[model samples]
Target: MAGEPQPSGAPTKGGWITFPFLIATMAGLTIAAGGWTNNIIVYLINEFNIKRIDAAQIANIVNGCTALFPILGAILADSFFGSFTIISVSSLISLAGILLINLTAILDTLKPAPCENGLTVCMAPSKTQLAILYTSLALSSMGLAGTRFTLATMGADQFDNPKHQGVFFNWHFFTMYAGTLVSVVGIVYVEDNVGWGLGYGLCVAANLIGLAIFVVGKRYYRLMKPQSSPFTGLACVIVAAFRKRKVFLSSKSEDYWQETHAGGTKFVKTTPTNSFKFLNHAAIITHGDTTSDGFIKKPWNLCTLQQVEDFKTLIRIFPLWSTGILLCTPLAMQMSLVVLQALAMDRHLGPTFQISAGTMMVFVMLSTSISLAIIDRFLLPTFEKLTGTSPTPLQRIGVGHALNILSMAISAIVESKRLATARSHNLHGNTVVPMSVFWMVPQLVVVGVGEAFHFPGNVSLYYQEFPKSLKSTAAAMVAMFIGIAFYLGTAIVDFLRKTTGWLPNGINDGRMDNVYWVLTVIALINFGYYLICSWLYEYQNVEKNELSSSSPCPC
Candidate 1:
């Protein structure tokens, strides 16, 4: 039923044949994206002579923009060009942006001179240089927004069977993690040791190759045409209800206007539920609301029962969704803060080898990749065997909340120890702390493990609970919330800088430990809030029994 070709302009029949192209493209694009973004703070500090705190702020904003753009890209795809066109054009845009970045790395004139030996002060870039850099970053972020999750949606669209879709999603995530791992470790190493120009040039090449691969697979893709935006349908329900505010509520199934399937069967055979009864007005049939054949004549004044139900579903899930914003904010802050910490600490792996500050996230990626395998192969099966039921997505999310709180506490403890060591040695204002960067590994690994549980759980919960028409948007929702969290992180950082001595250009002179402690407290409060929301939440589309039996994989 899922794989069959639809009526003219809908997705056509496509299957596993399209997997290699999409997967390969995802891998290349991810690697290319990481090549630039992973080491951005270091780049700004070293090449552009920006202060460490300012560079971290810029990195947060770039990360926020990159995450937020997907919602817009999804809207455009669902409303106008469709996924194939969007992905293709976006890849080209990314390639162009990367080329510009590479040029900046190659041409010394495009950047301010590097700070001279043993000097804290450095020259700032000119306005023209800043403009070039900003334009490149904007284009790259926009390109990334267009392709990232849309590719997943398009790949899933190719398969008709749920099992096949599950396998595709697993592979999709695997490829993505692998790409990021390689780029963060490998590409960052190249940028730090070899040359930034060569590092960004590789990114440009990867983007070109990935784009070519995707285009070559055009014939194999089951391209879905742009349809009316699901967002529009949801808005119509609200508007229609407001206009019919004085109308009496009714429980009768026959009172509401229902659309028919192709075979003349009612699209939504059941009457509206009592929950959010105000929205039911949108479906109440009124004189002249529809034509003789039951088609809507006044789109804003009338909606099908299905549209009303979809709006209600989103409303029901709003509280649970809001909790994720706060839950993610601490993690976003930790991500950037850890980078600054890594920059100021010892990163040696051996006598001749040194780890790049940006590559410190490799611990998180490595832990997540390994933990996902362990969960899928060991923990999940063991839990099901012991309890005679699989763990629910909410349960997984709850576990993640606990782990995140613990991770923040660990980070605070480690930062305090690092600060004590710095003070004892009188290392204030020094570029590198006397402490080892590996001291940060435990917290990084803990948070990565937390992500292993929560991210997939959130994805699964959203995809399963969202209305059928909004499945693509469901995939992008995670990105949207994470984007909001990054913006919040930026605000939190700015607020702290203005009000406290927790962050400075040189963290060695500031109370970095205090920042981690504050984050720990915030995470603790957020976890409690998550517990309350999860407890109050009830699954609408998925039964508890069904949820307990479903695979923990995102699909």
Candidate 2:
């Protein structure tokens, strides 16, 4: 709380950078990032001559790396530099990365020559070519990571009212998904039909424009000053608690670390809770913990009461977070494999019109975008009108779990049918199946709806439940979960390829139905685990009166 900056204008967040400008900036960046990433699998396969399964694995790895970088951005924004500086720097970095990718796409020497045949006999990129390709990928990934989630936090920073913040979140997600939908559908089509050079060039232009918009509006932003992270305090609590493990905790509030008016600072004092009794030792005033003047001379030897409580909050919600990992892994798996499935399936809507394989996931993006708007406008209001309360985060996430399981089951059935048609034509020998690509839509739509329920719900839980000091990083937590799921999906794919014939390079030749079935089982089990975690966990921030009309007020 030290050295907090004064607000610039009225409640509308400093009155300089308005909501529309920030939203526009976010949309542009989202479009730029999505355009390049959406069809990365196809690019790797066609342009680099990577195997189908290998391309999918690499895609997942790229997804994971890009998603994971946001945590570091959040940490820096909250702990060192503010969002404006970090965002500006990140935007430039991202612009540079996109330019590099565009260069590779434009210069033939940077890539391998076209395979006279197909990938079966195509010349792979040389070590030098690979180094340039990887460098471009890494730079682009880093650029994407720096801005994606940080933009969310920055957008929320523009509003004063909690209600306005909530509205911003909905619109933020809506814009992000909508922009991605356009990229996956429109730009990906360009990459698929027109050319990679032109497609990547569009992304570079988009990134440049986005960064320019953000920098122009920089002075108007309401900047939140960075303070030392409360996680440091939490760590101090753990260290002090262990050091004084044998020390007994007292019931007196005075025994804890709360600032008594001594012309220095102000801090609220509260009695320790009964739930986490052992951690109370950190707050217990003892011989060497405090100075003679009553201040904590050695910080590592003591902690504030809030620090202990904050640590407890994390422990309570981690199980819920853990369960959602598997929830997301199935979707990640579906996303990568579905592209490969589309590549090998009949994509013609008519003799004249054919769908690009990369554009198939646009259905998922569209479904999520529509569902977010509907859930925000109609579903939540209708539920509150019926039940006299909004749906709890757990309730929303629970619905996501059920829908995810169903999506996996649906995916399994569709794949099974696709395989059956492939076998009927004796199409295992390098032949594309006759099954319609439209068959992939149902499962994608279901999973998108699930994401609609779960993604925001999980983010809300983290922000509500996390300690004040950790609020900045709370948004990044969801991004980190997504990254982990992508990595886990990669591992699952690799394991299946190495162990069994269920995941051959060609899904038509392998038993893809079994892979989906396995994903379904994993989802079901993780859903059960989520239920248990939700049942046992308590909310850290929910008001007592609000709890009455919905779930039990356990906390």
TM-score per candidate, chains pooled: 0.95, 0.92
Score candidate 2 by TM-score against the native: 0.92
Candidate 2, 376-396: lDDT as tens digits: 678988998999988887898
Worst 10 residues of 1 by lDDT: 546-555
lDDT of 1: 0.84
Point to the candidate with the largest TM-score.
1
RMSD of 2: 3.9
The prediction achieving the highest lDDT against the true structure is: 1
Model 2: lDDT of residue 232: 79
Give per-residue lDDT, candidate 1, residue 109. 92
What ranges in model 1 sit over 4 Å off? 1-13, 263-269, 543-555
The global Cα lDDT (0 to 1) of model 2 is 0.80
